[model samples]
Structure formats: C-alpha cells, structure tokens
Target: MTNSPAGHTPNVVLITGTSSGIGLHAAIAAAQAGHTVVATMRNLEGTRALLDAADAAGVTLDIRRLDVTEAQSVTEVVAGIVGRYGRLDAVVNNAGSGHLGTIENETIDQVRAVMEVNFFGVVGVTRAALPHLRTSHGRLITVTSVGGVIGQPFNEAYCAAKFAVEGFMESLAPVVRSAGVSVTVVEPGAVATSFVANVGFDPTAPAAVGDPYAAGLAAYLARAGSSFASAQTAESAGSVVAALLDGDVPPFRVQTSDAARQFVGVKLADLDGSAVQRLTSGWIA
Candidate 1:
C-alpha cells in the first residue's frame, strides 16, 4: 500500500463494474477511506443503485461509464482518469459475467462470452493502466474466485476464465515488481450478490429430456444454493478489497474470509488432484 512513489496511499483509484455488488461497495469504501475513487460501469443506465448507495454512505465518487470488453473504452477511461488526476494510483479489476454450464452442453461462443468479460477484459484494462501505474508505483487488484484455484462442477466456462486470471496475474506480479506496481488477486468464496442469480441457472427447470448431466446438475445446484444461503456479504468483501489498498503491500493472493482461505488452501497444498477431487466430487454426489 505504501509502495507508491506518490504517497503512503493511492491518491486516485479506478474500479470497473460499479453497476452493483462488489464494485459498487468497493468504490464507496475507497472514497470513504479518503481516496479519489472513479466508479465506472459498463452501462450508464444502471447508475441509480450505486448513486443511492453512495448517498447513504456519505461519500462522493467520480462516476463514469466504461465497458472493459472494448479496448478503446478502456484506453480512453484510463487516459481520462490520468488526465483528470494527473496520475492513476490503483485499479480494481471487478467487471465480469457469470456462466453456469459444462462445455459439452454449451457452445464455444458461450464459453468465449465468459472469457471475453472475465479474462480478456481484465487483460485489456490492466494493459491500458500499467504505464500509469508504473509511473505512480501503484497497485493492481483483481477480484477472482475460489473456483479459480479449484474447478467446480457445471462451472466449466466460468472456472476457466477465473483460472486464466489467476495464471495471468501470478505471472505478471514479479515482472512488474521492479516497476513498483504491486499486484494482488482477492479470492472471495460465495459472496451474496446478483452475480449468482444472473448466472441464468434455473434450478427449478428440469434438465433437458434425459440429459446425461441431470442428476449431477441437481446435486450441484443443491449444494450451490445452500452455499449461497450462507454466502459472505458484498459489503464485507468489498471492505477487504478496499483495505488492501492501504496496508503494507498486500500479498500477491488473498482470500476474503477464513472459509475461502481453507477452500483455496486445499489446492495450494495438494500435490496430486485427490484432495480437490474428493472435496468437489462430494458436492455433486
């Protein structure tokens, strides 16, 4: 956090996907913490929720529209922020779409849809902001998922996109260290957000006639539903993300809760696939 050449904290911060959930809360938290937060979302029409939340939180944000999937949009937004503040100190890669389906049951385009927003979208934004971050010796934080470390059933596309982010960022951290841009990926387990509902999984809808994955899907959904029922709150998770912006340079990887830490720890310590396989298989059993 104090690694910045500008000061002990990031002066100007930009976050994507502020339309709702983690992005919305993180923007507010950062602003409340005294950072000039630029809250950006893919759609301008969806600003009411965030605007109202900011009003309630007693913090003001420089709101803007930014679609991470578009290269020109990303470049212009980053440029605009730097133009306004003269430098960008931090970026939170929080814009992503959720998908719920296995590869065979889904088309290639569907999988690519997830990747476009979840993975490539991140790459585009990070690329556009790095030069400025390099200038400020700032921070790069991405909100990945526990699924990123251990794949989950019926989340082939979503897990793949998250896994890609994990790999991309892990490789990028060291290379950017000399430039002084600290990188960290925040992994949150089941945060209570519209993200899950938007995944488009109709648990009540019977699987296609005689679908081979019918039973497994049912089991997975039951487990997922229960997990979501006890999911971490978005405000709780966002606070963690914002707090990372200040401490003694956060670790390259972090979990939002003790449960998330334990979930991800399984993969980190597993020499073979057995431990993860055992745990996840039980979810669909």
Candidate 2:
C-alpha cells in the first residue's frame, strides 16, 4: 500500500499479529475503511485467511513479516514500510501472548519471556514506528488486557507485563504529544479467540501453588474459558480499534467489552483520593 496519492486519503495503518484474532480482524476492518493497511505477523504464511477477507472486501492490503522481539526485525520492517509507503499514519500494537502460573513457581526465564513479548516487544515496535508516525502526525494504539489493571489469579506474569505496558504508554504519551503523535491504550475483556489454546504453561517446572490458590486458579481458568466461549468475538474488538484509528481526538485509553469496563472502572476508581490518603497517611501526615 503506497502513501495516499494526494496526502488526503483515509490514512495508512500498520497492525501487528494479523495471523488470527483481534489483529486479523482489525487489519481487515482498516482496509475496508479505505486506509492503506500494512499488516504484519511473524510470518505472513498463516494469514491467507486474512488476505481472503481483504479480497472479499475489495481492500488492498500489504502483509509483511515482522517479529516484534528482534530489534533488527522491528527496525527493518519499519524502515521497509517507510521506504515503500512514505509515511505511517497509525499503528496497532496487538501482538501478545499469555502466561499462566503463579509468579513464585515460574522460572526467571519464563517471566522474562512473557515480559519480552508483551512489554519490551511493544516498546521496540513503537520505537521503530515513531519516526514514520511523526511524519504522518499519527496515532499509536496498544491492545492490553483487563489483567493490566486488575489481578487475575493464575496469570501473574501476563498481568505484570501488561501493567508495565500501561505505565510505559502513560508515561510516553506526554513526551510525544508535542511531536504530533498520540498514544492510546486499549483494554479488552475476555473474547472467544484461540488465545487460550496458545497460552504458555510449563507443567514440570515448579515454585509455589498452595491448595486454596490452586483451586481458585483452576476455577478461574475454567470460568474464563467458558466466558470467552460466550463473550464477544475478536471482530468486535477489531472494529472498535479500527474506528478509533480514524476518530477525532481519540481518547488516551479506550476500553472494550462490558467485562473490561467493569473491572477497570472498579480497580482504577478503587485507587481514589480517600483510599490513597488512608493508605499513605504516615507519609502525608
């Protein structure tokens, strides 16, 4: 997809992890909306289905290779896009994975792996894309989970990574605002995708799982899987983020799903003045 011929077409958007789920849907939606879409994955071979969707929609798309973890991959992908397209108008950082286990039992390597993909990978992609984004005065949209804001029993590693991303994006937004780039974090609730199927869990490696906590974690996973089975589809989340990509003065954070709204609202609101005052009374007083 080349830059808008007249610099006044819809816009150009780049989305990550388009092999399946929300990323796949968002790429198709953005293309359908008339944007020049560059969709990337670890390998484009898995995205033939996405290509078919684009074909049916009559939207031209460019799907490419991008491994978010490799600094060279990130740099090369961004450089290739800018060289071919001239500018990048928006980016959706949707590539991520899940880790399930108690923090204590998880190996340091396991924790680092989760953080690499979820947090630092995001940082790498954003850093590589920022120059082009600045050229287009574009927006950066990140997809995070409700786990980022609230604690989920078995997903301590996943939650920690997302929480760190939340803090990172929040802090980076102000620094980039004046450079004509904006940042938004998207919090999605459970959705029925292949996410659970690919979740990383090491059964043999052992730290701490007490019986009660183990029971709760088991129940939570079951409930979550069932809820995902019954919840909205990935397409719903894709549409929301795609729409935000073109909307005016988009919010710094936009949350999707009733479940996400409920969790984020309660958790963030729970950190209000009264609570803070009481908790920090020793220092304040």
- The Cα error of candidate 2 at residue 212, in Å, is 6.6
Candidate 1 per-residue lDDT, tens place, 1-285, comes to 587774444389999999889888899999999999999999999999999999999999999989999999998999999898899999999999888998878899998989999999999999999999999889999999998999999999999999999999999999998888999999999999999999977788767987898899889988988999999999999999999888699999999998899999999999998999999999888
How far is each candidate from the true structure, as Cα RMSD in Å?
1.1, 5.6
- TM-scores of the models, in the given order? 0.98, 0.88
Which structure among the candidates has the greatest lDDT?
Answer: 1
**Per-residue lDDT for 1-285 in model 2, tens only?**
122134567687889988888998899898888888889998767888888878888877888998899999999888888888777888999999988877665698999999999999999999988888877778899999887877666777899999999999999998888887888999998877787668865433342545445545655656666677777789998898888777475778888887778757767787454543343232212
| True lDDT of residue 278, candidate 2 | 46
CA lDDT of each prediction against the hidden true structure: 0.92, 0.81
Which pairs clash in the backbone of model 2?
105-207
Off by over 4 Å in 1: 6-10
Q: Residue 32 of model 1: what lDDT? A: 92
For residue 124, model 1's alpha carbon misses the true position, in angstroms, by 0.2
